[model samples]
Target: MATISEATSAPASEAEALAFARRVLRDEARALAAVRDRLDGSIVRASRLVHDCRGGVIVTGMGKAGLVGQKTAATLASTGTRAYPLHPAEAVHGDLGRVRDGDVVLAFSQSGETEEVLRLLPTVRRIGASLVAITERAASSLGRAADVCIAMGNVPEACPLGLAPSASTTAMMAVGDALALLVARMREFTPEDFALYHPAGNLGRRLTRVEDVMRTGRDVRLAAPEESVRQVFIRLAGPRRRSGAVLIRDDRGMLLGIFTDSDLVRLFEKRREDELDRPIGEVMTANPLRATAGAMLGEAVELMKARKISELPVVDAEGRLLGLIDVTDLIGASPEDFEE
Candidate 1:
């Protein structure tokens, strides 16, 4: 039972400090595992309530619980469920109007007796909105008033003083996440649906389709396989920025091969300039790696990395070139960039 000053004043080795930190994390992890094991019918009931809700899900709490509720609401909203955070204190000041009939209100309070949270219950019920409570005690006032009560069983604080909320808030947040994700799964949420919510950041860049960023139409340099390399280069040379490769196609527009600036350099270095006047197909790389228009940019990047190529032709089901994906376009991308 050391005071804050006493704890700070005591000299502890790095090992001691690391051990203490590990203990705190272990305690919280154990508490979460306990909550997971003890989950009962209440979770099912809560999920059903949210899934059947025709209107948005309204989440509210006070203090740390409120912060967790806000994050939970955001998770739900981004995963296809309509949800928003309503501050309990603000609810009394007319913000309660944000709640409507058919909305499912989720209230988070470790104690289940938070005054501000309890004060808003009656109004939430009167609005014809169903109430769900996440608390440590299902028998507490907030639980009793709720249509469904999700109990966080006997979570002890990781704080040595047992006064500050620690393990309890962690368990509450975990439960909130579980509910949100379960509801998302019940609604059969897809990655496309997730992308719609997150259209910025690295996530957006990873989810972007090849067609979205690829060079198409006049921007693509296409040449017949029988065309001379010199003729192809002359046609491709212009003031506009260009891709490093030329797509070789047949009269039916089917992709046959690809000729790149690198190939031209190799030809000159090997003194094979005479071959350039022959059919470009004779020197071009045949059956090059390609992607589809609907494929993710990340996928095209992986293919390019594995094959050690800079350009990937985007084709349709019939192998007709739709566009080209350049490695420079995805220069900064990584495997982790595509993870949800």
Candidate 2:
């Protein structure tokens, strides 16, 4: 066999290389469109089977199709369905035990005759799992064995050699996404549900509830509206995490205003130490910007950026203070959160 550097020739020119790349992309795009046009009731039936599955979905395929299957399984799992990718070869080698009765097996085979994929169908059926096939022809053995077949019609590979899996795998992924998203819609999967599944990424952090990230209990310094500023500071002082502001609330627990360290500093900047003995509400920013407990942390960040405030108090429907979202609390917040 010739080494890669020995067998391959350099590109004639950048322009020619660019043109070839465009041709490949156009070919794949056209093939994908053809697959889209060929979609039929089979996809709907497959979606219904996946949506109604009592057990998890088990996606299986071989080679390139197996790679597509892994992505498809992840999409399904993230969008509210329980899904796992099982290698066809591994399925026969003890992984078949993962399949249960009432489970749906989604198998991908561009040629509809992948030996390993075909081998798993009998045991899957024996386990009482329904099979859904994605292939080039509905008449193929995998399709014939499936409860419903989503035919990819005829997708030509974009490779010049016409052997590599390109457009076919793309078509498989597109169809898999359609099936997964359709079922997610059927289940009415909400953003909150998605957030629960994705709890560590930027998306998860943005969708986090204000109450979940806010400083509650003693971490939040709540001062009564009637308290004097001098007394408020002395009482709120502790070794706990210091918040920049003191939330002023009425006797009934209704938030009234906010008095920040900035406010105190300004008071002492001039000869106004005597005013510290006055009621804190008289000097506080009354009816300050606030967020509700149910609001997302992203919305609170936007509010903070717009208002140029660092501390935002969270309240309930009746305006009782629940917690505070200080700038310190948003330590790992995205740069966009701090942008004006």
Best by lDDT: 2
- The number of clashing residue pairs in each candidate reads 0, 0
RMSD of each: 2.1, 3.2
lDDT of 2 at 277: 99
Score candidate 1 by lDDT. Answer: 0.87
For candidate 1, write residues 38-99 as lDDT tens digits.
88999988998999999989999999999999999999988889999999999999999999
**Least well predicted 10-residue stretch by lDDT in candidate 1:** 2-11
TM-score of each: 0.93, 0.94
Worst 10 residues of 2 by lDDT: 1-10
* Model 2 score (lDDT): 0.90
Off by over 4 Å in 2: 1-9, 335-340
lDDT of 1 at 199: 73
Candidate 1 ranges beyond 4 A from true positions: 1-11, 334-336
True-vs-predicted CA distance for residue 101, candidate 2, Å? 0.8
